[model samples]
Target: MLERIGITNFKAFACQDVDLAAFTLLTGLNSSGKSTVLQSLALLRQSHEAGLLDEADESGGFLLNGELVRLGTGQDVRHESYTEEDPDITLAVVKDEIRYAWRARYGREDDLLGLLEAPSGPTSWATRDLPSLFGHGFQYLKADRIVPDVSYPRSHDAAVRRSFLGARGEHTVNFLRAHQDDTITAKSLQLPEMPSTSLREATDYWMQRLCPGVNIETVGIHGTDTVRLSYGFGSGVSASNRYRPTNVGFGLTYALPIVVACVAAQPGSLILLENPEAHLHPQGQTWLAYLAVAAVSAGAQIVLETHSDHVLNGLRLAVKDGRIPASATAVHFFRRNGQTAEVISPSMGPDGMLSDWPKGFFDEWENSLEQLLD
Candidate 1:
């Protein structure tokens, strides 16, 4: 897991360090710099993968517009912040026993090419032994944009496993179908003398957990290339359901990819989500929170950016109910000044109580209520 992220001059953050927990919730008002944090990580990963930057490589620092990293005069770049002095960008992470720091300078080529530096550390700022953590280690999901649609192609490949559902969850059905047979067969084999009905029954049980009273089954049509998914609501009440991934309510499709991604993600993976509660009813938002907690317990670390009080309350409830360890999560709120943003982190206790409540935090609702009563 990433223990800390230090950013400077790379957006709304002039210079800041954020401590990360196993599950970190970033909540803030609009333009508070929540998305900028996620984007910086993404860009760093992209630069590393493309060889434009490296933890050890020097001379070639982050290049902008085909030149070395340069300072911008305005907020032309999303979440970007401009400053009078030369800008600097640094990201730090702790994995296993090693802590690594990647730093670069930002300015025009005509000004001066900045150096890329990595200092080693137990206490050192950079460690060369740190492995490049990439691949599905990070999964980003933006709300309302990740739902499925008709353009999605269904797949039944037996060789493929642990794939990300595209931005739009178009691949949801195909992914489920592909995993269905193996999952059922594996569970059945685990139980000695398990009846054939066991797999069928278990499948139904899991489906109902997501949508109560809903029945999900697969049917093969002789002439069709892909298997079809059908849904019903219990016995004696059956109807062929037609859902265009795009046409259905946004909540279902938006939430589906998250579920699939969590279950399919590997250990040591980082899942970055922006507003997982978007378009979800309050009840569904609570359910989403539960799913997120479960994912963390399963060994995936999540950094969530959200504005929903319901989502925060739900996670607190999960802690109180003992569904998740209170120490396993951290909540951070971003507040903006004229041009800079500061992060405030509050730890949650086992009883769903906060150790310290920062002023102005979660007070928007209270302020609105007061205004109404006044």
Candidate 2:
């Protein structure tokens, strides 16, 4: 698991180190550098996947624009306050207690920033022992996910060969179509009320948390290169006719990728979620958090970026109920301090209470209540 991440001279940070846990929550104000942390990891993964981080490849560098992220040139990613003395960008990760660091030189118009030095490790970062970020079980779901559509792309390479759901979850429908019948081995991820552990059934069970009795269906159009997703209400003789994705509640289709990602996650899977609470109601957001917690209990690592107080409270409830241990979770509140961003981590106790609740750290409800009472 990735225990920590260190960023230097990167976007929104002159230098920052954020500790990670089995389930890490990144929350803060808009543009406060929450996404930057996720982008950094994606950038590294993109570079490594493109063969730019090969062990003996001297020309290896950071791939800025790729399937996972589209960060612009070096000037766009380099911190504005970087001093001339140390103008290079650096990213480091601590995985399994070993520190791996990389330094890249800045080029104003170059999207692929050149490497300035080899990684600070015994072997190159691209060896067979690469970080789990580059592993097959890694999934990065961006905030702007797929909307309700009649048909989604069908990519055999992406869905079957690579087991990828696409960075924006554009390939989720096809992935579901291909893997719907696959068994979910992790008991924690299995819905207790549902008898079958198949991915499709579990997805339906979880989606019911958002909209009760709603189920999903995915199939390939006979002559098309895309897959279609439809929703159905009820079951057996009382079942309603299947409805197209556009005909259902918008949140159902929008949250499908998240449900599939968590339900299908295996041991050692790494899921980086951006605003999993988007398009979800308060109750749904809390349930989504519970799903993520269950994924963690099944041995998957999740780094979630969210702006939902309900999601936060749901995680606390998970800890209190013994669904997951407090030590397995970490919450970081991020905010801008002048030109740079800062992070304040609050620890969780066994009873689901936080060690600290900094100003602007999901306390708006109380702040507003006090004003109203006055």
Candidate 3:
């Protein structure tokens, strides 16, 4: 697994190292550099998948535009006040204590940033396996995901071969349609209430947390290369009429990929989520946290970037409730200083309380309540 990530001359950060665990929560104010961290991992995965992360050739390097992330050219990714006279951007990851760093020379208008330096050695499973980033399973869900669409694109390579749900979750319906019957053997991820432990059944069991009695169905269009998704509610005596996604609420569709991603997670999967609490209510947001915890407990590594205090609280509750140990989880609160970004990670105790609460770290609620009561 990727134990830590080190960034230099990246967007909003000159230099930073973040520790990753079974479940890592990246939380902070808007634009404080939470998304940047996820983008870094996505950027590496995108480049590696294309076989561009090669040390043999200096021409090989970070591919800014790809399936996982489109990070633009050097001007867009380099830190505004980048250090060193060379102005090369560097990103490194520590996997099982081995550090792999890739330095890319800056190019003004080039999306493919050439490598200045790459890891050199006899190749083995350490670099070959790359447990968290490759092989096992990977999913990157951007904040702006698919909405209530009539039909979604069906890509066999993306959904079936690669098992990717797309950055915006555009291929989610097809992925679900293909893998619906797959059984989930993870004890932690299984929903006891559901009769079967199949992916489709597990998806419904978890999706209900966001919206009660909600069920989903994805069907392929007869002649077209598209699939349609519909929702139904079992709320009342009147059995829910099967309705198009447009008829149901937006939150259900918006949160579907996240739920599906977690439900379909394998033991060594790496799931990077951006605000899984997009459109859910307070209770639903907390439930989403529990779902993330369940994914981690199932043996996957999840790096979540969220702004919801409820998500934070839910993680703390998970630790306190003995669902996940404090050590298995890591929380980093980020903040900006002028043009550079900095992170302050308050450790989680066994009791689920943080070792320290940095200013503006999920304390807005208490701050606002005090003023209102005063």
Question: Which residue ranges in model 3 land beyond 4 Å of their true spot?
Answer: 56-58, 122-127, 235-238
**Tens-place lDDT digits, model 3, residues 75-155:** 999999975674889999998798988999889898999987878865443337486785648999999999998899989
Candidate 3 weakest lDDT stretch, 10 residues: 121-130
lDDT of 2 by residue, 23-120 (tens): 99999999999999999888888888887765424577888999999988988999999999999998888887877777888899999888776554
Q: Model 1's lDDT to the true fold? A: 0.61
Model 2 lDDT at residue 2: 89
lDDT of each: 0.61, 0.89, 0.90
Q: Per-residue alpha-carbon lDDT of model 1 for 1-374, expressed as tens digits?
A: 77777777767787777777778899887888787777666555544544545444545444332211223422333235645564556655666645556666654332222436755333222213432245544566655454444443555432145354543444555666665553432321222332342334434443344566554454444566554554556556464455444544555656666665555545677787878877777777776787677667667788888888888998899899987788888898898887789888888989999876776777888999999999
TM-score ranking, high to low: 2, 3, 1
**What residue pairs are clashing in model 3?**
none
